[model samples]
Target: MFYERFTFRLIFKLLFINALGWLLIYLILKTKLWFTIAGLSFILITSVYTLYSYINQIRSDIKRFILAIKTRDHTLNFKNKSTKGSFPDLYNSFDDIIKTHKDIQLEQDAMFQLIRTILQQVPVGVIVVKDVKDDAEQMEIAFFNEAAATLLNVPAYKYWHRLKQHLPVFTAEIAHIRKGGKRFLELKIQDKLIQLSTEVIPLNLYGADYTIISFQNIKDEIEQKEIEAWNRLIGVISHEILNSITPISSLSDTVNSMVANKEYLNKEDLEDLKPALQTIKRRSEGLLGFVKDYRLIAELPTPELEFHSIGGILQHIHVLMQPFAAAKNIRLQVGQTSSKITVNVDLKLVEQALINLVTNSIYSLEDTENPLIEIDYRLEQNKLFIDVADNGKGIEPEVLEKIFVPFFTTRKNGSGIGLTITRNIMKMHYGSLEVSSVPGEKTIFSLVFNYV
Candidate 1:
């Protein structure tokens, strides 16, 4: 209230002083009696105006300072060069303060930008959560590259899935792996299996923890292990073949020399020699058959391709096996014949495979009463399916896994290259041969082929 009244009184005094001073100057110039009084009054009024203008300038500078502080820019200086009195020192001090504040702010901004650049190029998926406990935790996902997306099987645009929905089971598995100190955990989703590696590190601020997860595909590694196993088995089989054949050939030569020399002269010796010679002959024949089967495993034939109707091919197999089925008191039937189902296959190789399958079925039916073999073909969805089903004593689970393996057999005189050769031939034709069996019920062998 006093400031307002002072301003009003100052304005009134200035107006009245100006009017009275002008009147005095005019009268003094006219007469020269009160010239000194008018000069003194003019000087007093000029001093008051100068003081008022200086105070108002100071007020305006203070308001500008406050506005700069509200905008968080402390680098604005107050410049009042016209005031060369005691207030010059105050204005210079405020300018120095502004310079100091500007330096501090610049250093802070530089440090923030440096940290941002480091996080942006960290080469890992870095997620920063500002508040760990609250639900409104601000999350920033950064530094996910193309390789990371491919490894994780996540699309580039859609890197984040709700943790529970995409891999609920696998997330639990990953947690278990983390607790156990395992480097990675493999999990299957659809047709793809990914290995996830997780790590927990302390956040730089507020003593919180953040988790980082990395993903990789281990399917190629699994395939490499399987190939190594197969190669090792092949090496062992080759060594065994060498060991068996070297001694057999030496013994056969020794027996031939003795028979040529006719070393036994007594009647008892001759009688014993006859049975011995017959035993040797039978053993040699069996050993020779074994060698042939082993060679067949080592030297598989390349498929010779030909195009033929699948129905006619199965019909030919049925006719070829009529005698064997009849001998075993088994009925052979073929059905579901499609007229135009054709496949590019090695006819000779496929025929041999079919013969092997049918022969195995017949052999399995020795003790079965009223056994029957069915050979059929069908064209469904542009693929040819040939099925060979038999009602016989089915194979055990343990034996089924080894059925396609070379020199693995359950039969008394089985050479065991039959199924191995069959599977190889089907693979050469770019088809697949699958077998399913129950313990005492039917056994099925399905040959699947896609039309070319």
Candidate 2:
């Protein structure tokens, strides 16, 4: 509808040109005058050429627009764009396209810079490598952050081979692993021993494969962690030994004074020594028991692997601990699950671990008004979890942190290695023990195993 005026103008111009050409031809045929014919022929050729140029103007403009787009020349613009012409909508469409493209590019560049800045600021090293175009054997470094260069203690190289020459071990690790993995490696780079935590990730983008390698120097971190762990362990051992020995040492002095006070009197003085002597014996045995429990946790045997029925384990634990729950009037509920669900684990060790958890749960429920313990299994995200949850006096955050420390206990009579041994057993079975507590609400201990 908008081209109506354009079409009318085009038809009028065609008719005028046809009429002028016919008039020139008629004069040449009828008059037979030489000068007149020559003049008419010149005028006719000029009019035809002028008409061809008028039609060709739009095609030339279109060609220029396409060239500009191909060259990414956003500055090329139609100087006299009009709303009225042959298909007037075409006048500014090319300019609009260039503007849109420029906007998208600007946004993309801004986002890329933002991401680059973040990578540069982070302490962890990040490098992005991709296969060369049409060359699978060669790789190009698409991204290398400041942290990566600093961590490796080398210049940021753009090509993979150059970088590989400097860090052969790290490069080999990234090259060999196709899928993602995390590893802790001790590398000797530039005469310095550095421990690195490296993680590799593979991604497919725009039909091209890329490898993202992230690493961090963890030597200092590992040393710090070891120191902290040792402090906690030594602290626990010292507190337990002192708690036992302090009373024993004081009582020994009192017994010596009593013996000296009466060298003659027999039964009465001996009777007084009996309580002190018994007290020393009791504390000594308690300390010895603490040492034994610590040894049990420190020297756990590797689990002998076997596939055991999940339901069977739960059934056995429920039957064994039912009496303890009955004594406390705590309802121990075993969730119903398919007997078909089984796990690859050491039956004895796993059973012992569960028994320890359930026993702890039983104790935790001692003072609650309505006590309950529930044991259940869930298969989630390719992992098998056996959850032991209790409605009881839940563990406090501070106590929970130290519960797995050997001989660290809140209960007066607790040996405190129960959770430690349980956790060790799970580790031996290639599983993990995890606990979450909500002080007044509930506590859950999850035995996590990789589902096969």
Model 2 stretches astray by more than 4 angstroms: 1-71, 81-87, 131-136, 159-178, 190-193, 254-275, 302-328, 339-351, 377-385, 423-433, 448-452
lDDT of 1 at 335: 80
Where in model 1 is the C-alpha error above 4 Å? Answer: 1-265, 378-383
User: What value of lDDT does candidate 2 attain over all alpha carbons?
Assistant: 0.84
Query: What lDDT does model 1 reach?
Result: 0.69
Highest TM-score scorer: 2
State every prediction's TM-score relative to the real structure.
0.47, 0.75
lDDT of each: 0.69, 0.84
Clashing pairs in 1: none
lDDT of 1 by residue, 1-452 (tens): 43464467667767766776777677767776675666767776786787588578768776776677667677576565424533565667667766777787789999978976775555443333222344422333333445544554554332223433465775465455432232446677677766555443334444754445444455577679779758755764675566565656665675565568675567765674676567666666766777788788668788878788877887788779998899889999888455566788888888998999999999988899899999987667646778889999989998887787677778887877888888877878767898999977999997777663
Q: What would the per-residue lDDT of candidate 2 be over residues 1-452, giving only the tens digit for each residue?
A: 43585578678778877877888778877876888778777876787777788679877978988887788777877646545456556666767887887787789989999989999999999999987667654788899998889888988898888888888888777766546766667888778898988888889999988889999999998999889878988999999899999999999999888877564858888898889999999999989988887788888777778778888888888888889889989999997644778788888888889899999988888879889999999888768999999988899888878887766777767888888889889877667899999997999999999774
Model 1 residue 224 lDDT score: 93
lDDT of residue 107 for candidate 1: 95
Residue 29 miss distance in model 1 (angstroms) = 82
